[model samples]
Target: MATPTPPVVPHQGRRRASGALEGEVLAALQRAGAPLTPREVQATLSGELTYSTVVTILSRLHGKEVLTRTPRGRAYAYAPLTDEAGLAARRMHKVLDGRADREVVLTRFADGLNDEDAALLRRLLTGAVPGPW
Candidate 1:
């Protein structure tokens, strides 16, 4: 009797991120106010990614706490845990908090500021009185 043939299976491995795709996905999620399924996210992404690829990216971001997911039947609805600005602030705080010379670090940061930003900083500093409010 002829031996039965085994069905071919696709290899499963880690998917490496493309910078453009990652940025596009993140931007889409940021623009959306509610959780989005993989299909919905892919649809808003201008068809730049496959459904599976989108799922993989979402899963990776979810693992990193960059995004949160809620169960919806057999799939998940994903949303950004924090906005870009919030994420940046969190990262900046994490880095700055670990430094030995926070004041020097802040001074360097202030020194590096552009004219408009420096002017804004000056205004903010001048507007704040030491008292309470």
Candidate 2:
């Protein structure tokens, strides 16, 4: 007799990349341009994440100083301390913080930038305030 094949099962939900949820939450908060309660944030999200999960993400971000929270009735409302660009800059600074060879790291980063970005960086470094590209 031929062996029977096992049944194939599909994944119930799509897997997200690391930090994707956090990024999504941050984007929602930024778009609000105002503090949001956990319930509000959960509603703003895709409804995949739970209220407790949203609260947890907000608490974690507050701990990281990425977000600020204030008391609102029984729950805390959360707001981002900085915009997306500011968050990216913070991440870059964090990556360079403890390195003994920051110059090398910066050199590698500069070298990796495309011409347009390189020129933009040069203009910024030279104290020229150019309009947004």
Candidate 3:
């Protein structure tokens, strides 16, 4: 009987900031106003990152529905389905909605903000007041 080979194990450690790369790629696409191949993204990153790594990240992001890709010759050009802000808002909403008490969740969210952020949020909610507080 032939011996079976063991399955390969994935690297375990701090996970890659795949979300950040997706955001960056999306921003680059928005700036370019067109689809970009992995090579293009690698060139844009310059010496800060490796081409193959960027390609892998792009492929993973594309699989995650964070990005859309179109075949261009032997390679694919990828673009983001939504902007970073929209993606972040969707994720935040998902997290908040999963809670049992939405009111408490929102209250805690407000309370977690820094003083400046809280004040700014209050101002936005109440609109601009001409007089000083």
Q: TM-score of predicted model 1?
A: 0.67
Model 1 agreement with the true structure over 23-120: per-residue lDDT tens digits: 67888988998999999999997886799999988988787678889999899999988888887777789889999999999999999999998987
lDDT of 2 by residue, 1-133 (tens): 9999999998778877638988889999999999999999999887878998888888888888899999999999999998888888898899999799999999999999999999999998887966543
What is candidate 3's lDDT per residue for 1-133, written digit by digit as tens? 9999999998765654866776676677767767899888877766455788788888887776777899999999988877667677777888997999999999999999999989987887788644332
Ranking by TM-score: 2, 1, 3
In model 3, the clashing pairs are none
Q: What is the lDDT of residue 16 in candidate 2?
A: 74
Q: TM-scores for all candidates?
A: 0.67, 0.83, 0.58
Q: What is the Å distance of residue 30 in model 3 from its true position?
A: 3.5
Please list the C-alpha lDDT of all candidates, in the order they appear: 0.85, 0.90, 0.79
Prediction 3 global C-alpha lDDT: 0.79
Number of clashes in every candidate structure?
0, 0, 0
lDDT of 3 at 76: 94
Report the error of model 2 at residue 124, Å. Answer: 0.7
